[model samples]
Target: MKREVRIMNYFPGCDPTEIRMSGNYRYYLSKKGERPLIVIGMNPSLANRKRADLTVRKISKVAMLSGFDGWVMLNVHPIYSTNPKAVKPTVNNKKQLRKNLNFIREHLNKFPDAPVFVAWGKNDGVYILDTGRKMVNDLLKEMGRECYAFKLNKDNTPAHPSRLPYKIMIDAATNMNCIYKLQGS
Candidate 1:
């Protein structure tokens, strides 16, 4: 099933063509054209091309405040659904993941050195979420990209971009420290 791309007016100028849903959900990219930040989300929420999802909106705001020229978004899961249950079954979809990695790789190639923001929140202790997390981690390692975790709570997990307070997200931005890396080729 394909995600729908409506023709509604979206704030900050959302164009249907820009939302890449070839393999999965609508990937809302920033117009600044300088992807200085790489945002990794758990998956696509109800947000689509018609409107700027909360995650994209918040991340975009933080990117601007942090002085980043622009930001790009990817997800741990390839399923595009507003409901979490929809993506739960594909926790270990290696085939889909490989396809999605192409998107990630292309983005990394374009923005080779952009700092990574690992914002994939642990999905209620689901087994699939864990598998997805592992795949994302390994992919980053292979790409030789340094990943950072958001200081969302005591655990300092990658904070999920929802209706989180602007100050909270801003503070999490400061907590961006190297949490993942690759040593050898």
Candidate 2:
């Protein structure tokens, strides 16, 4: 049996302009605002311009409650996949990775003051995810921008927001004290 995916209007005031996508890749998703909480995640999921997956909603909620007018979600891997294990890098995907990294740099340059939250989990030992995360970390270090997270896992990976408790998430978001500076600064 095949399951159907439903796309709904989770953001009442958001129009299609808030999302940016290219085929299976999502560069970023945002709500209307001058100040947006920028998030870097493992990959895109079911969320898109027209829908709000659980993860997207969680990130947006944390952003909203943290005094940001809106949120912008980017990802280490640009491809949309509910299961990380299913994502593998092909030649085309490698191209996508370069493009994805370029867009990330552009976004960071675009929003110099926006708080960046690195929320990609351990990536379940996926090489591409690990590489992507490391590349982004290098970029962060190069840009000299401080990043934050709810907490780090036992493995020291940034805690993915989905696993974090709502109250903790809000506290971390509001306090903005869980700073995790990349090593080799």
Candidate 3:
């Protein structure tokens, strides 16, 4: 079988259920003609009612235009039971972090060459900077592939800030000699 290029989607702690409502997201995925592997965190931000809707649309569009493949949901979204007043979290705590690392390891084993892992949200950079080096190093020891991280922000829209990160990611991917583009925008 031919090796495939997969774009892994990582949304920290966002409700995955809301993704289906976004039309733009559907359109983008349809256009890409590839199924993407989606990895979402458990404790996503619950603020900003419109945030989830907007994200779904944006991500779907970008994936389709970029010709990305299928998605895999790594960490299962948490379901709060009786205690609704529990403190909502932002960054990945130790236990959650370990779960994420384990998930990455398993996926990398399955798709050794797929380079790009897309992380949505501002804090993703912090997570990657903190744990990515160690994770990548371990992966390299077993598999020769090198994985790179990218931070995608909501400011890429016309009304928002410039899409510098997008441009940077594209440039880096193009310049790299490797067959896989391990970057996030």
The most accurate candidate by TM-score is: 2
Candidate 1 displacement at residue 52 in angstroms? 1.8
lDDT of 3 at 34: 29
Predicted candidate 3 versus true structure: per-residue lDDT over 15-34, tens digit per residue? 23322212111101111122
Model 1 per-residue lDDT tens digits across residues 18-39: 4566545443354445646678
Candidates ranked by TM-score: 2, 1, 3
Which parts of model 2 have CA positions greater than 4 angstroms off? 1-17, 183-185
What TM-score does each of the candidates earn? 0.75, 0.89, 0.39
Query: For model 2, where is the 10-residue window of minimal lDDT?
Result: 8-17
The weakest ten consecutive residues by lDDT in model 1 span 7-16
Candidate 3: regions farther than 4 A off: 1-59, 72-92, 118-133, 149-185
Full-model lDDT for every candidate? 0.64, 0.81, 0.34
Candidate 1, after superposition: displacement of residue 55 in Å? Answer: 1.3
